[model samples]
Target: MEPIQHKIYHVDSFHSRTFLDTYCAKKPEMDLGEECLRLTMEELHYFFKFANIKGGTLIDISIGPIIFHLYSACECFKEIILLRFNDHCIIELKKWLHDRTGAFDWTHALSFVAEKEGISELSEEKDMRLKAAIKHVVKCYDDRENITDPLVLPPADCVLVTNVLDVISKDKVDFIRNLQKFTKLLKPGGQFLLYGALNATYYIVGKDKFHLFNYNENFIRKAIEQEGFVINHCQVRPRKTESDLTDFKAIIFVSAYKN
Candidate 1:
């Protein structure tokens, strides 16, 4: 089947989510829309173990609070860097910290803001494990700049890239090439862990809709090899839900070593 071509959007994630709900949701329930959420999370644990992240730099590029929460529990990296793809997320994050207007409700940002208000209220009885996961994110916020250029990242002992590759640009080849630019920032023999889902939805720069891309693991692995990194481990999984119109699948436990 020919891949679906979604109308591109150049907005930040929040706006894109809004737009997708309005437009893409027009067809059917987005149930099973995100098919591989589980594999992504599962691969995360695998990455930490494979990279020997303890006592290393763990940089989660363009990763939101979820990654922050998980890795913060590790006590692995001497320093953890949470880099966002855009500046708007940084500003929004800060608002959740000091904004008293109580007008804006960015629930996602709360992961990094709840401590400021001591809002134990942020706790969702439904997901206690999640709420207790990354207490550091609730207390501190790291606002770093652009990630389109891999050159910006400092040398990391391990770099965990999740769901970032297929969303950057529609051109997969170029995206892989761009992703390679990050390897130089890794210390010799350092590790890079990448997790991607099959046909995942992501927000991008310029139009107004949630975009979907089927990330090919072979393409990603080959590109990592081209960049002088050795693939350590890689696996993929298809996720299913109760209302299973479609299955969300993902490539997991993919780790590459920079030699």
Candidate 2:
């Protein structure tokens, strides 16, 4: 018998709807959802309130079309510029933003965020607020010298990245290189919030298994520090559920500021 071979992300076909259905769907009993959706929202809510990182522009470079993490962020940042490597993700995001039919339902995630904030606002209102905060969704190429080439983006006050580097980076060097590219988008003294899985080698989207750069907390801390960013708050949550879909040991969130 032969071992199963996984397909590489970016190199292989990735279905946006499949990815959302598998991971971002409203599943209360699933630990994957609890950790990625709920825990991430909770951390961001607290981080924004405590750190007070309000600003004019924020650059978001995250995996897929997941927007749950931004529920709390819309309140803090006036404008959000979303950068994407894939066209499918951009289309899916636009569908939700424009209130098009067949968009992925994120009301459950919104409800959780509202509860955390102790707010009585309906999910529709919160969704509208988030949609308004997002200013643009632009396609990006990682291979280019300037990731956001042609349309030069203004230096942002903050940048938020979630689980993107791990999927795209082939090695530590690639990871650091991509990190540098993202950091260049930030203004001096800008905040960089990163959320990633620790000790993860792969994750499943649909039937395809995509590569993940296996890294731990120390490696991430060192990588960020090497870029001259001052670490502010770092949190790691151990994986609470048993699943064969992914092999990540924990999830990590780090808040840092460029010096």
**Per-candidate alpha-carbon RMSD to the true structure:** 8.1, 2.5
* Candidate 2 residue 8 C-alpha distance from true site, Å: 2.7
Candidate 1 lDDT over residue span 1-259, tens digit each:
4554554322334453332232223235545333333234334545454545564466665433233234232445555555555444444434433444532343433333344324566664313333332222212111212333423545767766665555454566546554755454577878777766565555332344445455666766777888888786777665555442222354444677877
Candidate 1, residue 60: Cα displacement in angstroms equals 1.3
For each candidate, what is the lDDT?
0.48, 0.89
Worst 10 residues of 2 by lDDT: 1-10
Supply candidate 2's per-residue lDDT for 85. 87
Return the lDDT, model 1, position 197. 57
Clash pairs for candidate 1: 9-205, 9-206, 9-207, 10-205, 10-206, 10-207, 35-248, 36-248, 235-252
